[model samples]
Target: MSEISREILSVGDLNRAIASSLEERFDTVWVSGEISNFKAYDSGHWYFSLKDEEGQIRCVMFRGRNGQVGFMPQSGDLVEVAANLGFYVPRGDIQLTVQSMRRAGMGGLYEAFLKLKAKLAKEGLFDLQNKRPIPTHPRVIGIVTSPQAAALKDVLSTLARRAPHIPIVIYPTLVQGPDAPAGIISALKAAEKENAVDVLLLVRGGGSIEDLWAFNDEQLAYTIAQSPIPIVSGVGHETDVTIADFVADLRAPTPTGAAELAAPRRDQMLQELDAIMQALLQRVGQRVEREAQTLDQLALRLNHALPDPDRMREQISGWQKRLNQAWLVRVENWKRDQGYFQSQLEMLNPQRTLERGYAVILSKEEHAMHAVRNPKELNTKNAFEVRLAEGQVEVEFAKLGLLK
Candidate 1:
């Protein structure tokens, strides 16, 4: 053969080489960053990307290892994640394989949310008493619903068509995945924190239980209740209702209805205004029309007069005296009941029982004594006490025997 050389390694040898080289290069590096774009995949693996003010790298922690770190690291959490940088050949992506994760700084907002929610729920601020009533005709409207959601679009579209002049304020939030609860809690807090909005409309499109769980969060439900502002909850589709609905002052079957409830229709309002004006005019016209007839009737009435006097007052006094005598009879019957109660009390008195000659025996432990039926439960020389009607006596002996 001509001078030839082929550098060949088995697939295992290749994988091992790649793995060892990658592990060696990245082994001791510590990265500081905030967790973002986190995703836990099926197949018992976690897939996420970590980023700092600088940049981001996709990272994964296998199920068992990721589970050891306990609480999930949410997006926006500042974290110093420890991991080995490696490449997943199947996807050909160089990713950081995370080993452990912990919260850092403002990243702890999610943790703090859980803590406060637990505390407030324990104190019951989110209780039924704190809930406010939704306005029947809300003049100024506020929205706590997610601005990015399709449900928001549906709401806006419906409002524009049904009631255009009504103003809508949007509060943007994450409506799905791990970051959802904190995002929602933040939005709700922010709406109140800013303090200018009235009659908050909390709306969301319909989805499965998992898709809708963020609104079901007890903290969110409580936030809706504890809000100084009245809330109208519109979540999921028509059939969907969450704890937020129960805790909210009003529940809309759909987000569109929530918009309808919060915004008064221009057409309907004008109609009502017109009706009120008509009603006032009709009443005024009727009164003016009846004025002449009323004057005539008044003159006729003035032409005749009558009065009733002292005899009626005497009759009333006589009835009052009879009523007072009946009340006295009731008092005498109450006194007789007291005497009957005294007799019953005398019958139940313990001294009366003692006079009957029945006696009670007790153990030295002060428990009511039976016939020592369970000899196994007793000890030799156990003390026995006798409780007589007049007094008590104590005695001890080597063994207790029958009365005979």
Candidate 2:
């Protein structure tokens, strides 16, 4: 150019331009450094400076991004971060916006963990529909764990205390190191072959990620998924998760937890049984009372159906006097009249009705028998007596199937 011209720009404008250029010029990066001046605000944002022996840089990790970090970073902690280059226009300084972070040495292992978790999840290994129900009352419980493991002792004690009647079979195996996965598989196969236990427990105590790495093996996950008996996995502490935990039918927080889940407490089951028995007895009492009411009603109907015996006797006496007068007046006609009156008297007799399959139902109340005249006069709560031609029998209406 022949002539040079100077253009004035405001401080804010210059800073904004630089910030835009910095954001566009750099892609996301991985940085390794030691943390310094680490501060976590109430807003959940993290503000810190990452430094090495040569230089230091300002960094900010917002709440959304920082939550994914497994561990919180302290001032002296060495960290590896994946971040994007950014600039703070107000402060006129360059800074790194962290996307994810981890302890420096754990970066590779954490990455692998994430990769495997994602791959398994895509294959539907962790679906809720795939899980089998843990037995409420296992006849026999099988445990797969190291013989030397403290978890085994804890599980045994819990199962014995909760359900002493149930038997336990232990399949000892290695729970750590490179050989653990294969050993656990063998133990599981042995348990399957024996088929003595109703449910199986795969358990171990808590350990570091590296120490528990055997549980993360792909083959071990496949084995747990393929087991016919329901598997309850208790591999580590509550916070520690493994592939075995996901593949198992049920996951418990600890070995003792697994035992508690598999075995129903004897005392608790007895309490439930007692409650059911009481409820059934109460129902039976109610049913008996209702049946008595029905019988009382049927007895009242029978009372109404029968003619009064005293009234019949008085009518027979009057007829006998008439027959005696006719016999004296005409002796020849008296024989025929006598036969007709005898037949009439026999027809009116209560015993004749009883012999013809009729029964008088009486209500027994306060140790006394009373004629069941009306339903309101009888006590439905007491047993009823039926007077038949041959003998009297006491009965409850509910058992006779007459009401329903």
Best by TM-score: 2
- Pull out the clashing pairs in model 2: none
Per-residue lDDT tens digits of candidate 1, residues 70-134?
A: 45667776676777888776555668877776555423544654565566667765576666766
Please report the TM-score between candidate 1 and the true structure. Answer: 0.43
Model 2 TM-score relative to the real fold: 0.59
List TM-score per model, in order.
0.43, 0.59
**For model 2, the run of ten residues with the poorest summed lDDT:** 364-373
Model 2, position 64: C-alpha lDDT score: 98
Local distance difference test, each candidate: 0.69, 0.82
